[model samples]
Target: MNRELVLAPPLAPPRWYRLRRQLRDAVLALPRYAALLLFGAFTVFPFWWATAAALSSDGAGIWIFPAAFLPNDPGLRWFGRVFYEMPFWRYFGNSLLISTATTLLVLLLTIPCAYALSRMAFRGRNALFVLLLVTLMVPAEVAIVPNFITCAQLGLLDSYVAVVLPNVAGAFGVFLMRQAFQDTPAEVLDAARVDGAGEFGVMCRVAVPMARPMIATLAVFTFVAAWNDYLWPAVVLKERLKMPLAVGIFNDLTGPFAVSTNLVMAAIVLSVIPVVGAFALTQRFFLSGGGLVRR
Candidate 1:
């Protein structure tokens, strides 16, 4: 008996075929690239316009045809005026203190709560989680009056504590962390326990390390919220010295610099810098989701 042998082609495809496939993929991806660029431009244009307005000599260029997007005579005078003419630094400091405090407090409260809810079996755990979800549905406006009264009774008005207290913890942070913890591999947790690690040790060493990305994501959200919060801060703080940038800008900048569009834009730019930087630092965690695990 005899058998015929068949020849096989090389592992790599022909050059022409590879080029054709690459060309096809590029052509197919054109619409997606176009959409991304369009949205990116749409998102970036406002910040560009604001920056141009802040830099413009008279800020009249912002209203002009093509100059609205491009400043006619860019200068740093408005930015200098932002500091000289108002308590911009004070507002910035207040916001920073409140936002930092709020983020830390929210993390401290949510981490243990989420760990317990995700790993521990307890009575009324489901009911407790449901109650938390219900809080998310309730309008924050509904709590404003009661919160104000509580703050007043505690004599915390016009202080950093007043502003930070209302925002220190939130149901959203707990829910996000709970979801992340629940996604962690149970085997890893069990291994930690088998090594003589208690529940607290397992949570601290195994669970938290796995959920670092979610924790970063929640921290960024909480910081951004606390930084940009206007209503609660405005309601609780009466003194200009304690007002965060969001509320201070509205109450103070609206009075004199309202007409000075350049100064107003400069102040806005300053307020936005911290938020953008914070997000930029933690952006990878958001993109990586729960996969940014520690080794």
Candidate 2:
């Protein structure tokens, strides 16, 4: 059998075809670029407005026709005033203390509980976890009165301990840490056990180091949640000195003080810095730690 060979057409495109192809590529890319820029601007505009208003000389004054996003007079005086005029440092210290204590307690309680729940098997384990999930559905407000009575009975009102203890181990923290531990490899855990490691040792040595990223993520989240907590702290702590920054600002910055809207803006900015900075510093762990393997 014999077959005839056929000549192939030229593979290269003509110049106009190439230019039209390039134009099509550019057109397809335009919407993505436009969406990104629009999203970025929308996200950034609020921060800019808050910052500009915080620095404006007439922050509390009526708006002018030609609005300026950047203040004509930028000053640090409000920052100083925030500290000096309003028992700000005391509130700051209280917030710092309560938030730190809460985060630590959360880590201490969550790590072991989550690790055990994830790694160990016992009777009613599923039921217990389900119960915890049920508790999450119970709105925090429902517990406030009972918690208040308990705090009163324990003589913990007006104290940092009152604020810190009730919120120390949240359902979300447990769920998050549990998910993180589950992502860890079972083989790694088995090897640790084979190497003379007890259950506690295995968890501390193998599981925790592997989940550092998740832990850091949880720590930042817990700290911020506690730092921003207002209702519970307000109910427990009557004294202004004992109040966290949230309640302190709401209480002292109003009525007699009437918390200048600009000063309030400054306070809001100051409050946000720590949370943003914490996430920025630990975001690598948060992003990278979400894998399903040791490597």
Candidate 3:
């Protein structure tokens, strides 16, 4: 005779048990999700308000109490006034030129500088890096007076060079690019060298392609900064024609008469469109791992 043992049936979760688990998770995550949504709404509300103001009529008085979320009578009349009443197109073109030139020059200078700092073993490398880092801590306000004096001495006052030259050797761009270049795989660089590729060849064929994301990031940042710059351009450019859009807008808006809030809003909306477009076009690189060159 053999003794046999029978196994009990496996216990399955009750229907209410799954529902309870989901409820517990939802309760735990509710605060965090609510906070995130609140923050997003807070950040986005200003842009919505600005867009509404831009589309509103002159003497709309939307900025007053009991502000309307959407304009009652929306029109593009303010934008038309901005364009036709002022030299808006000329200022826009000047800003575009200065920003583009500054971005290009900064990229050209910073990329090689970052590559050298990141990849090469050389004397004073650590010291140089430390110095560069220190400069970032220094405020631009401290240097503005000296910069202006130098611009005057060089007779570069009122010139585009005065605005663009100061930004070409940006500390932040160099730092960002250095981090990007350092992330590149060493083996790939070594392979290029083993194949008799020179430093320049390796940089062109391997480093640049991998660093596309970082470069695009840098370009966007530099372009935005240069585009929105007002203080330096105002100090350097005495002539109305020589001034960038930022300073030009200030000059036009704050004349003897009261400034039209709607028109100013319209100008701001117009100014931001190009930067938004640029960011949208280049933003994919930030996620695509296009900047990181691997072996």
Candidate 4:
């Protein structure tokens, strides 16, 4: 009787069972996946359109009227005009210098300040953070008058110093650094201390490495903000030669008898390349979180 017993191989779930599970997963994912795709397209389409427009010929009527999604005759003619007809290179260089300097100085100041705020517990620390948050809520226009007056008093008007100095110690950078530093493990710091490392040594060796992602993120933010800044430079810098690319580009767009749309688009393309290149280069740091000031 025991030898007579037989078994059938386990059959795959009834086709409907497998189908039902797949259907459930698809249903659950549909809205989220759809939303993500839609948002991505929304954000990216304008840049694609801009690139398309930049490649089109001047006075060609491709971008006018109803606006062409694809150019009729794509050429580098506008790009040529950007370089040959305008001081495009000079403005680009000035923007690069200002943005680079601002980013470097902000990093130097914010890293230490954030470490102090995060690691060193003291009176008014929370208050200081709260004050910064409050300041963030207030529009930049609120402070522009006083800032302008101060710059004038310092005899910094129409100078690079006027543009770069005001932005050196940025509230946003300090806030970002502080938040990032707070996430560093206390045990790690204690171990460093046990190894006879001083505060600065521990910060360089331990804290900085852990906060690299946040730092890269901060750098991207600062670089974009500085590069796109127009009002401050326009207000402070009266001379055309001293103006940053943003102001210069705006002047090119609005100051002429009839704006060359192609040249303006070319300038736009040129202004964007640096930021895009920078993001592409430093974006690796964002993923690796590698540049911690380690021992």
Best by TM-score: 1
Candidate ordering by lDDT (highest first) = 1, 3, 4, 2
The residue-by-residue lDDT of candidate 1 on 143-236, one tens digit each, is: 8999999999999888889888887768998899999999999999999999999999999999998888788888998999999999988888
lDDT by residue for model 2 over 1-295, one digit each (tens)? 8999999987999899999999999999999899989999999877777677778767744244236577747887777777877887787889889989999999999999999889999998878888888898989899999999999999988888889889887778888889989989999999989988999999999999989878887898888888899899989888777888889888877855574777777777777777788778766664333542223
Each prediction's TM-score against the native?
0.92, 0.85, 0.89, 0.86
Off by over 4 Å in 3: 1-19, 58-60, 287-295
lDDT of 3 at 6: 89
C-alpha local distance difference test of each model: 0.88, 0.83, 0.86, 0.83
Model 4, 1-295: lDDT tens digits are: 4687689888888999999999999999999899999999998776666677778774576556446557648899888877776688789888988998998889999999999988998999989878877777878878788999999999999999999988887678888899889989999999999999999999999999888878887888898899999888899998887789999878867767136766676678788888889888776655433443332
Instruction: Kindly report which residue stretches of model 2 are placed more than 4 angstroms away from their true locations once superposed.
Output: 1-42, 60-68, 288-295
Point to the candidate with the largest lDDT.
1
Per-residue alpha-carbon lDDT of candidate 3 for residues 1-295, written as tens digits (9 for 90 to 100): 9989989999999989999999999999999899999999998787777778889774566766446558748899988988888898899999999999999999999999999999989999989998999999999878899999998899998899999988799789989999988989999999999999999889889998888878888999999999999988988899998778899988988883236878877888888888889888777766543453223
Model 2 lDDT-worst window of ten: 286-295
Error of 1 at 267 (Å): 0.8
Q: Which ten residues in a row have the lowest lDDT in candidate 1?
A: 286-295
Cα error, candidate 2, residue 292 (Å) = 10
The predictions' CA RMSDs to the true structure, in order, are 2.5, 4.5, 4.2, 4.6
The per-candidate count of clashes, in order, stands at 0, 0, 1, 4
